[model samples]
Target: MSTKINELSVVDADKFTVSRTITIAAPIEKVWAAVTEAQHIARWFPEHATLSPLAVGTTGVFGWSDHGDFPVRIEELDPPHMIAYRWGNSNAAASTLESGETTVFRFTLETVDAGTQLTVVESGFDALRDPAASMDGNRGGWDFELDELVAYLEGSE
Candidate 1:
């Protein structure tokens, strides 16, 4: 058997930007709710999330249904439109870098004829304490997570 791992985008490249678009067959409202609401988010993004959707700074902790916890700070919010945040990768702690050095994650919702066009962009990673190994792992991880988002929206387990 071969012992090689697949990468999605590369984590420690000179550039740091990862963006993807997924069209959901539901209305913008549904997609927005799935992303904003704590319960809805828990269903797709995390297993549990404590969210404060007020007009000010909101925050929450998202973790896997069984393991992991990533604290998120809401930077911007607009109903059925956009939600931006600073996402701290809890799993990043496993590495030798500062876990607090977060990468920005943004999710925008647009009403399209096909439904809602959700765009996700993550950036801010010029350097990693452990460049070579970490980059590949992170790149692959994000790709898998994005695929999970699609499956979650598709209501497929």
Candidate 2:
């Protein structure tokens, strides 16, 4: 649970996407809880998240600022291993259209030598009219978010 951003693994850029993986020094269950639980999510993710853990048709909002919320619809859930969702596209009270499109985000977790390996992938941006903005924005956002997550998991927050 180091705050050293440099230590995280950077997912190589794909055609129209960016991704990253970070190994948290915690067991898979602990890492999973930190990610899937609403209370734990708020500690690291956006300050406000409304989560529903149903196997199908579950949705929630991420982010706590005026920046607008991203609608998260669970597309796949595999216990302590994988959680895939469609992020962006809204039914939330308030939201935005930064190009009037949405992307698929997948969080894959696994147990490693000393902790859990979490990989985050967000794709489907070729449809975004503003390619530069979309890629840059998400990349920067992920970096900051991961930094915060590391701190939160380490109890530094």
Q: CA lDDT, every prediction?
A: 0.65, 0.72
Alpha-carbon lDDT of model 2: 0.72
Q: For residue 98, what is the lDDT in candidate 2?
A: 41
lDDT of 1 at 21: 68
Quick one: best TM-score, which candidate?
2
**TM-score of each candidate?**
0.74, 0.83
Candidate 2 structure quality by residue, lDDT tens digits, 1-157: 5533444334334577768888777789888887788788888888898887646568887876767667777878898998877777332223433444777778899998857778898777765666556777778778888777767777776
> How many Å off is the CA of 134 in candidate 1?
5.2
Among these predictions, the greatest lDDT belongs to: 2
Please give the TM-score that candidate 2 achieves against the real structure.
Answer: 0.83
Model 1 quality (TM-score):
0.74
How much does each candidate deviate from the true structure in C-alpha RMSD? 6.6, 3.8
- Candidate 1 residue 115 C-alpha distance from true site, Å: 1.1
lDDT of 1 by residue, 85-153 (tens): 776643355422236556667789998776677777766554334444444555666677755655676
